[model samples]
Target: MAELSPTAGESNYSQDIQVDEKLVPKKGLSLCSTRYGIALIIHVCNFIAAAQSTVINITMVAMVNTTDHQFQFNGSTEQLPGGPNNAPDSLPAEAPTYDWSPQIQGIIFASAAYGMTLTMALSGYLAGRVGTKRVVGVSLFASSLLIIFSPLAAELGLISLIATRMVQGLVQGSIFGGQNALWERWGPPHERSRLCTIALSGMLLGTFTITLVGGLISQTLGWPFAFYIFGGIGCVYCPFWFILIYDDPVSHPWINVTEKEYIISSLAQQIHNGLLSALPFIIAWVIGILGGYLADFLLTKNVRLVTVRKIATFLGNFPSSALLVALPYLPPSYITTMTFLTLSCGLSPLCQSGIYINALDLAPRYSSFLMGTTRGLANIAALLAPTVSGFLLNQDSEFGWRNVFLLLFAINLSGLIFYLICGDAVVQDWAKGRKLTRL
Candidate 1:
């Protein structure tokens, strides 16, 4: 098995040099430095992208008129249960609501995932070919623009809204692969868990914040504001991103040589829903950061890296799946439901340190491509999850929700078992051939 020297691809480095822990420059290495700054900004972009992806989950309640079905009572029309939560009296007289079926709502919800599935792999390829700067930057800006127009699209028609959301998904999907590509250049080996988790924890926080406030925004200012506020934030963020971010440390003028060397040398090693509706995610975010720290701690302690990854994967998947299986059967109480859900969501993030970062270890050179390909296929779940739930729920709400949970449990367990049996952290034979570079 051959491996590229850590410094082989870096500029002006013809010979290998030993780096002492004490000798490695430590100044300008904290969160204040350029690389960390990039991570933080990527965090913000993730926050925006994730918020846009899910805001409709909460806001749809206000967006749809569930009272389309009518009944006769003394020649007066009465509305029956078309969906949950929305009622004629609860919303403003002028407020718009679509006469969409639960199944239609499912399609709307899943549309973005569908779009994401289509583009994720291509986005990864483009990121590698053209650079993440253009791919991610243009995608973010386009997604934001789409988000701002989402309400208008809804007003135009259901098809318009779904099309808009799907387009948003297409563009935003690039972000996942693109960000990973960015990290391939910028992330250090030892700091892999912490940095990756920090960037990803934004998704949880974004979900938490949007789920917590999205409904409130819908009820008070109307659902459009939810779109406007979040979309606007993404638009506002683009200039700063373009100005501050570079695809790799070498190209970043602001980065000092010491940090650049540290990042490149380290590279050799490679590397949510709502309050009340949001509770689980906030817990997950906290646990995710903690899990990152724990993973890094174990790595530093010389734990077999693959072993650490597996343990985290098991902790994340097994318990969470078990809880999902048990949740529906539990006594129907708010506290009981929340407890299982909170625990499930919280534990699931441990995988951030496990299966999530395994690609970087397995193939630093192809990490972005692997991420895009795997995630694109895995998005089949996202594409089907809501639609399946909707169909099942339509059959029977309680039983349907139960079935949904059970199905998830089965799927997650299967994936956990497969990965436990096969996942590896060591670099692969083919991937080891190339030194780290743009592609």
Candidate 2:
């Protein structure tokens, strides 16, 4: 294999590998240097993360049910579960009572979001300091460990569960951040959009699979088993990732000189420098916040509006309360939830790719910085979503959920305005005006 050249104007210590022109055409390079393997590994990692998220959702319902059926009405010595502090009195007064209320559930769900918010903001800095591969591997391992322990925390008390979930969220945020940086480093320019879409789509597939599998496990083996199974799956991926992935294109033995050149040249033309590069970050932030909120809103309300009435009618056909009892037993609810979740997963990535592509189009060199900044900002919206949703649900008004959706829709509309104003495809002339400056 030929030795790789250092990036122009950057020091040797920077270890930046520039792609040459010969890599563009498949015929010019050997199979070993191609990007297919790298893309596949990244996608696999994404799938695992996506599946993990869905499994948590499924497990939450099962755990709450288990707590309700086994502890509360049994008159056990356990204290009633609280949100952040004291337990609420609204818990159902019956046998097999649960300690925590819906409000508490919302808090647990939001814990991850809070952790994710902080980590995502710092991800770019971390990746720059350490390297994408290390960050990715560490985050994946940490997330898997936290997920495995989450059920044990649940058994301890509500506070434990929240704490564990918050840790998982922090790891998850790093995963997202690291993965984004990895793509920028490894993916080819021509195929970035397609690869991004594929990675994201796999995430949707994983989300759907998790719901299906978690629901089945809950119905048959029990709810705690769902966490065990998903956590195990996450652990399995770690070894595979370590063996298969590399941080940069030239580092891979299989990638050929021709393909590497093609990738480098394709990316070189797209980078922009200076404050002008920040424009895409702002645009993506506005878009992602709206997109994230809309996804949660639709999952919470719109699906029910579209399908719940029919489901209720079908259940009503059965004996009294029989449908209510049977609903959890059936897989349709999980399937419906997964379907909606998948749509959100699918849409958000495509939207994000479009934004990123525009960034590259306008400023190729600054793409990484712009992407990092925008994603960090977008994550702030993610942090607010679950907490805001919890607050609305706590209101106990008839239109609580409705109000949440309304707010989400308004946010999405605001994003649309930004998209129209700032999301132009044409590259701006910011970098051309400045003298050549190397980082």
Candidate 3:
């Protein structure tokens, strides 16, 4: 086997590296390739899932009535619920706004997470038993319908809105596990990193797009439009998913015979040749996409797989932790603070190539179940992080933010250290269906 020199990282020799032909396309890379296309389409599904989930976070700012703030009108300040001076006529006409308390808002923010935590493990198991195409596609369709009606639900009452969101969460909770199930069948072991990360990156892209635009849509067209537009996109994408995706290459109608053989042969070799296989809470798209390519490139150059996972994990965790430590000390400019925060967030996606993909390496058969278990547990943190931060801020605003950053730094640092020490890429015996016999 070819091996890259230890000093190769210090040089540009990677440019001259010859990737194994089994993983590389002899005809040259093209998006039209079947597996790549499937990955890309799954990326869109992730995008929609993320957009629907987080758009509410931004639009809620516009949805709530700012009763405490006074608006300037006719050179005299008047309370909100009245028109502001010289407001654009083209802006959305006044819509009903909620007077939800901070406590209620907190519940709304965490409502989906509650549902997600409850359903995630079950969804994973279900995806494996059923099939990824229907599980994921149906979830997306159901969530989209709920989002479209979210505005109506909110107007009806707080309970109605929460119920709608909770149900939406229940459906979307299936998506991640379903995605892993798809990769189990569709991804060749050699190409696992790039294929999985490419799809996962869509979540980041969707988050960024919704964050950047959700506010504007809420401000101009009204908050309801944000829900409508994002939800509608998910609905429209369903038909394509049902039409194009199959459980595996062997079953796909349009996959060429050569590509089918290549995928199947690659996976079979990995099972016999070696054991086992194979993010962040918020991420950036570019980092993930690039990190996946880098990982696959390193693997192609004969770098040990475990070593590559460690490298990616360190890059993902350490710098972000350090950045969090320094964030509280940055100059108080929002621009500067936001720049640093974005940098920290952008660093997180590197794990896509590391611990994030490790589940598939350990056990292809149970990838979905493992993903669900891990993600569901992590989301407990997601469910509580905001509430915890809010509680801290309520006690003391300045130190609360500082403590939050410090807490994140400590958590990330500890996780990085543990993973660096104990992380493995080897498949476990159980993953290969070895039964433990009683003595």
lDDT winner? 1
Error of 1 at 392 (Å): 39
Q: Which residues of candidate 2, in runs, are more than 4 Å off? A: 1-23, 27-33, 66-98, 269-439
Across residues 121-221, which tens digit of lDDT does each residue of candidate 2 receive? 46645665576678878888888877777777877777888888888888887777656666656655435544555554556556656756765776666
Residue-level lDDT for 417 in candidate 3: 90
lDDT of candidate 3 over 224-305, digit per residue (tens): 9999999999999999999998988988999977778767665553221011100121234456667878998999999999
lDDT to native, each model: 0.68, 0.52, 0.67
lDDT of 1 by residue, 302-348 (tens): 99999999999999999988987886555555566667767887788
State in Å the error of residue 331, model 2: 54
Clashes of 2: 22
**Candidate 3 — which residues are off by over 4 angstroms?**
1-31, 69-91, 269-411, 414-439
What's the lDDT for residue 306 in model 2?
A: 21
Please give the TM-score that candidate 1 achieves against the real structure: 0.56
Provide the clashing-pair count of each candidate structure: 3, 22, 3
Worst 10 residues of 3 by lDDT: 272-281
